[model samples]
Target: MPKAFPDRASTGWHSHRRAQLLFSLTGAMAVDTTDRRWLIPPRRALWVPPGLPHSVTMRGRVDMRTLYVEPGSGVDLPSSCVALEITPLAQELIIRATEAPLLYEEHSIDGLVMRLLLAEVARLPTLPLWLPLPRRAALAQLCEALLTAPDIGAAAAPLAQSLGISERSFARWFISETGLTFGQWKQRACVLAALDRLSAGAAVARVALDLGYDSPSAFTAMFRKTLGISPRELGRAKPRTPIVAHG
Candidate 1:
């Protein structure tokens, strides 16, 4: 299905009986579940497994496209929510599938498109555009605060002090709980925040400074290392609507 959401519009907590691949041809969205939050920028999609309660908030005017797969479709999909990098081929196929008849013949062209699209979805590379929340209540609250107002310069000493734990103990517990070192987790949080801002047309330097980076170059280096693409390149690669497929 193809739908347009005005800037800041939200689809309050909901779940589907079938799995869904949520993509946007333009703008960006944030998908929040119980334990993680995913930022879906242009050219990326979020795979929501069946029965996973989630909410999507538009970062801008989003031209959203969604594909629903029945629960027993026999396709191998992730059990949890993930952000997938959509290749050009998959982008075109998704657009076509959204336009195809709902009940196209099994051996027809629409069927072939659907089959190819499913294959692409099953193999699409997952992006590191999500932040996993810690299970502990106090730690989770701290993480949530950082996500709400991410600061690249946030330090473990201050965070640990706020949690009433020694820095060394906090470091050990953090890695054991989240599977990432404190610095690593902080960087991921900053990257997700930068993506959200960049997709909304924020200038790279402005976003860098706003996120507490010393310089745009410093921020770009981290962004490229984590996401494999520079901020400017991503901004320039704005998504375009694919031509509708004719039966």
Candidate 2:
């Protein structure tokens, strides 16, 4: 399905009987589930497992494309939510599928396209664009606040103090629950927030300062290290040649 959403438009919490591949051709979106939030920008997609309750909010005017696959459809899909990096071939396949009739002959060109799309999606590499939420109420609340207003300078000591726990205990618990140190988690949060802002055409300097980075260079360094691409280069990224899918 191909649809357009105006800036800030949201789909209230919902779930589908079929698994979903949510891709945006333009703009960005945030997908929120009970225990995680994914920031999906252009050239990336979110794989939502069937029956997982979730919601999506557009960061700007988004040209959204989605594919719904029935359960036990013979495709080895991911068992959990993931953010996948969309290759050019997968991108083209998705667009083509969206244009085809919803019901098509089993051996027809449309069917072939659908099959290839599923294969491509299944093999697509996942990206680290999601933030894991702690199950503990207080920690979850703190994470929610950070997502709303990320601070790159956030330190474990202060956070531990706020949670009324010793720094060592907080650190150990955080690693046990999230599989990431407090510093690592905080940096990931800031990077995801930066992607949302950068995708919306926010200037690098502005985003850097807003995220509490000392300077744009420092922010760009972190962004590049996390994603392997600088902020400016993301906008200039060129699409790879599409692979031809034959019947």
Best by the lDDT measure:
2
User: How big is the positional error of residue 147 in model 2, measured in Å on the Cα after superposition?
Assistant: 1.7
User: What is candidate 1's TM-score against the reference?
Assistant: 0.91
Model 2 per-residue lDDT tens digits across residues 1-247: 8999999999999999999999999889999998888899986899999999999999989999999998887988899999998878898999999998888997999999999999899999988999888887888888888888999888889888998999999989888777888889989999988888889899999999999999999999999998888999876645766474466
- Residue lDDT tens for model 1, 177-247: 78889899989999988988999899999999999999999999999999989999886654555546566
- Candidate 1 runs further than 4 Å off: 238-247
Estimate TM-scores for all models. Answer: 0.91, 0.93
User: On a 0 to 100 scale, what is the lDDT of residue 160 in model 2?
Assistant: 87
Candidate 1 RMSD to the correct structure: 2.9
All candidates: CA RMSD in angstroms?
A: 2.9, 2.4
Candidate 1 global lDDT: 0.89
